[model samples]
Target chain A: MLTPEHIRDFLDEVKDPEIPVLSLNDLGVITGIEVAEDGFVTVRMTPTFAGCPAMEYMRAEVEQSLKRHGVQAFTVQMSFSEPWNSNKISEKGRKALKEFGLAPPQPYQGILVLDILEYAECPNCHSTNTEMRTPFGPTLCRSMHFCLNCRQLFEQFKPL
Target chain B: MLENAIKDLLYKIADDQLILGHRNSEWTGFGPMLEEDIAFSSMAQDKLGHSLAFYTLLHQMGEGDPDTVAFMRNADQFHNSQLVELPIGEYDFSLIRHFLYDNAEILRFESLSQSTNEEIAKIATKLKGEVRYHVLHANTLVKQLGSATQESISRLQQSLEYALPFALGIFEPSKHEQELIDAGIYSGEAALQNQWLERISAVLEKTHLKLPEIANLQPVYGGRYGQHTEHLQPLLDEMAEVFKIDPTAEW
Candidate 1:
């Protein structure tokens, strides 16, 4: 009696190739998972950023994870039907991002105002006294920030 | 007819992104500062990805594959505006162009997110989120430098004036504009232009820079119908050089 939950558990083993610390499930990119009675498994994913080079690699990881779990006749699709925003990152994912020394995005409602982007809490010292240095960073989903309190320059998982 | 209209719309937008993305890449190691260097490079990567998304949609609609369509097209075959194809001149000009171009782009995607075409809507929704950061970056720099030292302010002002007419070219009307608007696939270019003007004006107002009276300026047009500056063809050649060497070879 394999369920989508079981499939999800298998996917939990797959981590973001870039972040490494965050699992696909906790990243909230595993948009939909279904296991048909005929044993056809369908896994859907959305990219954290449309330009993320790691998406194709992540899709391949999903397929390999499913295969390792002994599942056959599966289709892994990438789409924007559900689109990815920082809010989609699970509480566990936020914890993982913080633990990785990256500031987790603050949850926001409605439109993402510019103020939210200008502000980031320091991951090292837990200080909100930080200024965004640049919106673009080494990767698509990150922004550079400087913390005045701890005098450290860090990256944040940018709030979309 | 509706499909053709949609394809026409996609082509212009895709071409704009691809050309500007390439221009942004030219700044990879040449930026005035290290942070700006990374910023432009990262933005180049993002725009290239965005162009690929639109090209993929066009392929799904029965066009050639993304690489073929992007790499094989000639200057006269492209539908991008004259604004994007211009060389990234000085850093001030590049920054001003970025500020003007991205402001309009954000508004375009915002409207397109509500498009009746489901696929276009979905892609727009996803892209608009990423573009917010671009707009933020542009506005932030424009404000800071626009109000900075005398040399910086004057340089930015001159660039803004030089880039304005060309920026207006971004909204050149499509031949099937009416049809697309009627089909709800797109909001018409005129409406988009008006919104763009208002938005850019608001941002400029925040700075010491003056918004020139664009009402009297002659816009550089015809890029929508494949008319481009002398700069576009060489750019295409350089961009396609490696791809032409071995089109069949796989990475």
Candidate 2:
């Protein structure tokens, strides 16, 4: 029987577009997958932000993945009430982004409302010499920035 | 002004803000700088939050539930302008549009803050604070990118020129324009558009970019009439899918 574990295993190979090295499962885009007795799989997802551009394709890709595995009557449900933030991604996803040359979002600086960190430390060298290039990034989920020291371009995972 | 007219105008404003907020929210985690990522996302949240405030006024006025007023309304019913409904573009385009839109919004909100209508004045005053930050942030980006190398200037100009006409649509007239003007609810379209152009040009001139031919640009009808571009449908579907499935379900 193909259990939820099987589904998880399958998604492990799927990479998040923004952070290409991290699997969607690692990033927690696939929050939960329920396999019904009738062979229907209901995959629950939450976008880091409600308007993430990758979501539409992510939904379709999940649907196709299950169909390929011979699961019938599947649906991808995207939820928003609880909302998604950096905390949603697992420990594995954090490590993956860091190693993959992307900076994972730092934990809340104990401030309830806003974290007042001025600049991000570069993923390439961990230098705090990064300056923001664009408030909006190549995609909706990321912002554009370049590291001053290395002169290398990189994307920072935004705080929720 | 007329209550019915005010209701319609508010919806237009609310819908534009909400839809743009939704579109920009997509950039939350994916921006280039961690700080900027949060900034862009925060702006999106502000847009949506402002929309909600306006929608609540609508709900109280007997329009409908706030969520339903926002989510359940079909494509034809939303009154946001063409500029907001377009898909999220490259960073330069988004930055340019933000610079243009926020300045206009600040000016518009300032006028709204003074409306003879208590409700409009109250909401506008409340929103005035965040609107100021939005303009400041955009102005900084405009200054930086405007002074940046050739590549940045080209990208920003392309978006600025391309979207200029649709951008004008933000100041498009409501069906009851004169009533709103005579009653002191708003300054009306002609005054607002001229102000928008003057402000937009003044900022763009600081950059090395050419101002889009102001006199030739024409407004598109999307926001008031609820006709949006191709980009809005997928966004609406994703954002509304859950709520649409069960409007009454709390989630």
Candidate 3:
């Protein structure tokens, strides 16, 4: 009776290690979930940044989430077959990021330009009057910006 | 033979990233400004991650695990271009090296994204996006400083001149260069160098910095075949220090 949807539903409880408000499912890193006739499950995930230190932790958390859901005989794998871009973050993920005080990335086309890095809607004031301070941030997935309207420094989930 | 060529290409690129990542880390707390500190540190983390991806690919190609291959190797065994192994001298030098180095790196990854090898292609596709930010940072700073005060412009120009020869060495071809190119594994280093030249020239043109006559300079070769400056061994020693303390230690 267990379906991939059921597996996905169970994974909804697992949040990103760095951004706790965002679930792994909403974060768009859970690339695939499969349930076999033999009652084995396989989960595939990819990193937002290949060097993301949180990836191993996230992978382990996926395994733990499955075990806690009373599922056994599961395997978790990380790959780049479906690489991550900021566009992968679900709308729910974007909402959670904004509510968490991080500016959500602007939906970008397939090509990312320097202009995209400059456009951060201020999470505090919802202001478009912002300037990017630096592309590299405290985390590889975020960039620093300052909002002229809010007069506050903020971080944006960098659009990859 | 084709496999050797591919592995050789992968090793050099991975080593360049790993070594330069370490050098960048040295600026973690030492950058002239806090933004710069965060920038270099973030770049270090990204580069380290990039190196791990390539090392993982090399592992899949039957090399040792990423840890063993990265830590257990001697300086003489590394294949990074000499440009990456040099000491991070001053801010000017580091900035110039970063500008020169990443400009070529971005082009290399862009070209490799179309590689006939699917796995390499996948990694190249994923990484080129991340590296784009590095290029943006480098170009912005290079243009700003290359046109700033007299001292800033002169220092950057001096660093640029000092770094050019080694920058050219990044294109040192392996014996299998032709084989790799002909097989569609890679497009060859010569073509990459030409593209790199155009890209860097375009950036420098926006600033006061002058591009030296590269044709007149002898390229400093040998790092691809394990010839490194005296700086590399010390870097390797420091990098492997903790790992060597207990090779079996787990985090």
Candidate 2 lDDT over B29-145, as tens digits, reads: 887767667777878877876787788788878889878888877777778888887877788878877887888887888888889988788677656545665676788888888
Interface RMSD, candidates in the order listed: 0.8, 8.3, 0.6
Residues B1-251 of candidate 3 have per-residue lDDT tens digits of 89999999999999999999999999989999999999889889889999999999999999999999999999999999999989999999999999999999998899889999999999999999999999999999998998899999999999999999999999998889999999898789999999999999999999999999988999999999989999999999999998999988876
For each candidate, what is the lDDT?
Answer: 0.92, 0.75, 0.92
lDDT of 2 at B138: 84
DockQ metric, candidate 2? 0.04
True contacts kept of each: 0.84, 0.02, 0.82
Residue-level lDDT for A88 in candidate 2: 65
lDDT of 1 by residue, B30-79 (tens): 99999999988988989998999999999999999999999999999999
- Tens digits of per-residue lDDT for model 1 on A1-160? 7899999999999999889999999888999998898989999999888888999999999999989988978999988889988898999999999999989998999998989988899999999988999998989899999999999999999998
Highest TM-score: give the candidate number.
3
Q: What is the lDDT of residue B111 in candidate 3?
A: 85
- Residue B192, candidate 1: alpha-carbon lDDT: 91
Tell me which of candidates 1 and 3 scores higher on DockQ: 3
For model 3, state the Cα shift of residue B15 in Å.
0.7
- The Cα error of candidate 1 at residue B97, in Å, is 0.9
Model 2 CA lDDT for position B119 = 76
Sorted by lDDT, highest first, which candidate order results? 3, 1, 2
Better of 1 and 2 by lDDT: 1
